[model samples]
Target: MTPEPRSGRPRSSSREVLSEAACELFLEQGYDATSVSDITRRAGVSRSSFFNYFAAKSDVLWSGFDEQVNAAARRLRGGEAVDAALTGIGDGLAPDALALAITNADAMGIAGELDRDRAVRQFRLQRELAARFVRDGMPQLAAEVRAGALAAAVLAAVWAWADRTAAERVLRDLLATTIALA
Candidate 1:
């Protein structure tokens, strides 16, 4: 017998299960050594199911940012623009799920690449956010750019700090600097 085909809607639970399994393997065996087949076997799902959920393993880390960013944008949409943007970013980063992603060695293995992806994402998000702020009568592109810059900078700072200090301290400093810059 064959399995039924998936429709276009996102399958959150399966994706979440695959992501959790991937993180566990990544933490245990390291990222480079883990394969899609290994992840599929561990998750007790077929290869097709995994592909239906994520384009690639790295995508799991990328998935939640947009939703969180949108949520942040909504929260800050009508408020003091820079303050609102930072608040959104800070809130986005504070979730425990993010901690799990970062702590995994396989996830960390993708860090350099992910950082680049993040910077690009930040730039795109900033451009959209700047437009939103402007439409709401905010006049400062520089401030908005600064807020976005600080957001990306905070992540880089946290990566560096994580090497020498605790994750909490790194996060605290990142939040402080991001907020201060905005």
Candidate 2:
């Protein structure tokens, strides 16, 4: 007889588990003190499994938001309106790794690193937004300025949403509000 089939979760779930474990460990032991091995152990996965899901421990926290950024890039490339593409990027986003990291940055001893990484992401999005603006006939300097403001507002909206109780989050709406306020 064949062994019973496992009702196992999708392989992708390991990423989530690893992120959760990493965040908990970071909060408990501090970022530098928590190794990839510690996250793997806490996640009940192998080191190889962790590597398969994440290039580095930092990826565990940033991957979700990175995907959103990339998706926005694709939309911009396809010539969607900047406001539509950028604001809608957070639609259907759940409170995932980025949210956890944002809320717990200080507690996890990751405030400095988080800020650095956040700037990288912000600038990356700004570049894409600026390119799209240029494509739509704005001057380079003006495009850069507008993109910088919009990108800052987008990230700020994410921070605001993460800081709030989960029940209060509707990221796209908050994004629209933030962009308008900006």
Candidate 3:
């Protein structure tokens, strides 16, 4: 059990603990069954403390996903291809990547209340990718559609693999393919 997150902004350590607790509970009790109270208890924090870090249990489950999205954006700007960037983070970065991400996202012990947030987060990530494509001189409409497709493909692949060696293999393959294209 970890100490509660400070009253102000949530600390990384606390957030990590929350995420771990959420994962454990989600796996043990199933995402649909686990409660915020269960997670807080597992994390050794009070209910209020749990709320301090994450508005809900789902937020705790998907806490680091947004970070991965940002990493993808950075990787794109750094001259690394999309597949290479996905491989660097996990394994596959295409169709397989989306599957892995979905599975991983689902593992976060999400409650019904958090579905809207999850969907919105995904939409926002797609938008980010679309903006990146526009910067690369793609036409606005084409870039938007392509960005959404690319983001969707990557997310789907990630969900399918769900933190497995297959995910790693997919990522490596993507990197290799990207390098070949370059």
Which one wins on lDDT? 2
- Residues 8-85, candidate 3: write the lDDT tens digits: 434667777777777777667777788888888888878898887777666764555556667766887776765566
The C-alpha lDDT values of all candidates are 0.62, 0.87, 0.61
Off by over 4 Å in 1: 1-12, 74-82, 89-97, 104-108, 136-144, 153-177
Clashing pairs in 2: none
C-alpha displacement of 157 in model 3, angstroms?
2.2
Model 1 residue 97 CA deviation in Å: 5.6
Please give, for residues 7-105, the per-residue lDDT of candidate 1 as tens digits: 632566777777778877777776667789888888878889888867877666556655666666675665545554554554534333345655543
Q: List the candidates' TM-scores in order.
A: 0.63, 0.90, 0.62
Q: Model 3: how far is 126 from its true place, Å? A: 1.6
Q: Rank the candidates by TM-score, best first.
A: 2, 1, 3
Top candidate by TM-score: 2
- RMSD in order of candidates: 5.8, 2.4, 6.7
